[model samples]
Target: MFRRFVAIVAFVALAAALTLVAWPQLLGLQRAPVLALAVSFRGAAAAAALAVAVVLTAVGLVLHRLRRGLGVLALLLVAFAAAEAGVLVVRGVGAPDVPVAQADDVTVLSWNTLGDSVPAQVVARAAAENRATVVALPETTEGRARQVADLLARQGSTYTVFSRSQQAGIPARSTSVLVSTALGRYREVTADGDTVGVPSVVLDPAGGQNAPRIVAVHTTAPYDLDPATWRSDLRWVAARCSERNVLIAGDFNATIDHLDGLGPAPGRLRTCRDAALATGNAAVGTWPTSMPALIGTPIDHVLATPNWRFTGFRVLSDDDAAGSDHRPVLARLRPAG
Candidate 1:
């Protein structure tokens, strides 16, 4: 009787896991509160499924004569797990590496500074090391932005800082953008009154005729508190991306999966992860610095329009020790002919 119960429990667990792995959106499970937890840890779920399959297969082989029916069920579970494993592998594969950027390539760095935890000097050093032409900091305050700008100036960088206003009594988070003087003049662009906290700025290159826009984004996290606002914030950013000559970067709070219907069209905004995968580094994640990058969700990104070609992409794992919960994403891009 006890052995029968064990078999039943294993079968139930495997079946539920398989359903989630196979088709989350088919049953409206993607938005379900209970299933949303599974979506966030899809990588870990795949690993767990593989482990269960191996254990169950071993048990089935050992007791084939005593429990022929159990052995068959175990085999079915193994097949389902294998299918999920294939999906995970394909999703995790890195893109092929493009050639390293030329001397004139523009490098942009995006990070969420977690309010005041990250020191201005650390941010400055990282920007200097990468020689970033544009830096986007989400969840940064006005005072912190100034400190970062001052630190960069000390390092011989002439970066002008633009940030959303921080009301005296309000506890709202702000996004900040730092444009290097070498990139020419730039000004802030408003994205309607509702989305004031998300910073958008346009840069007029010193010698180039066209002006490109940069948006530092931080959308609300989709949790029990208010998932609607989270979805709305993402749509707003997507609308901005619909325009030409724009580069959107920072903590989007949504993964590539969550961005499905939010953008102008499918495949409209080019994600840096494509370059990272091509370069054989798709395993690198950029959130919750405490966890290994391979398993953490990559909520931070540097996405660009079709007008720019990505030459290199990297998730700066070394910055995990820099006090912020998110590691920085840096991408090198050149204008597409």
Candidate 2:
């Protein structure tokens, strides 16, 4: 009986570990009818880890020789699992994305123009009202993006970079960066990625020795898109921003708990749930502001490096809801000095 119980415990532990390894992949299946499977990835990973720890603990209590080994392994597994679960839970529960500032710092804002209709004017207004030092706009058309730049110029913005479409007039369905004279004073360099819509910038305030790099990306959504493709694109974005103070902001088109291969990138990237909700509207819903119910998921997002913190964050939807479906988002950031 004791031997049988030990075997059962080992089987359960092994099963849990296996589930953790494949849970993220299973959720990526965009076409999969099991919607619950996709949304439950984080919870499932946490459960599996706990189950493994419990089973190992039980087995360790019964086995005299393997007690030390099992206890050590179980403790390690539980610690790692708890840490992972804690981060996910904090993100899922919706924490503030705004920075808690001290005194001297620069402010940045990120928003999706919802295809550049009236939303453009709204974003322009919001930027002007807030006096954002740097502005990031995603899903902007060539014409609409120019309009945003022009609007910023009216409010004292001098430098701007818009991604050009394959055709001269058309604009890539990506994102662009606009900087005020204050930000431009720091040497600015922008690089447009091929596979993904990413423009990275390095800012050296006053041409100082220590400068920070910011990579802005507009990630592809999984809706009817392959997770593998999204993963490849995300990998490219990650590679470019690796080991730097990267700030990924734009319409991700994928929720934090988005379904895997079933949707877009399976294991590569995730929506920052806390940031999304904090900067999104309760009534406005997700992107394509027009069809809130059909695509009811918070897709737009802004993720900053650990060093860069937010002071204020909000989703500008009430007045901005003119022609487009998405609401513009604003965030005040405080980069560590």
Clashes of each: 7, 18
Tens digits of lDDT, candidate 1, 1-337? 9997987787788677667745465564553454554555545555676677677667767886745665656566667656655654655644434345576678888888887578888898889888898898887776787888898898899888888744442313677788888777776655353343444333334455465677777776767543666666666777766667777778876655555544443223433223343344444567789987766766777777777777878888787988898988888888888
What lDDT, from 0 to 1, does candidate 1 have?
0.68
Clashes of 1: 7
Error of 1 at 35 (Å): 4.1
Looking at model 2, residue 229 earns an lDDT score of: 49
- Best of the candidates, lDDT: 1
Candidate 1 wrong stretches, greater than 4 Å: 1-17, 21-37, 54-85, 92-103, 165-172, 191-209, 263-283
Residue 235 accuracy (lDDT) in model 1: 67
Worst lDDT run of 10 residues, candidate 2, spans 265-274
Judge candidate 2 at residue 190 and give its lDDT: 40
Alpha-carbon lDDT of model 2: 0.52
Model 2: per-residue Cα lDDT over 135-170, one tens digit each: 766656656756777877876766555443323433
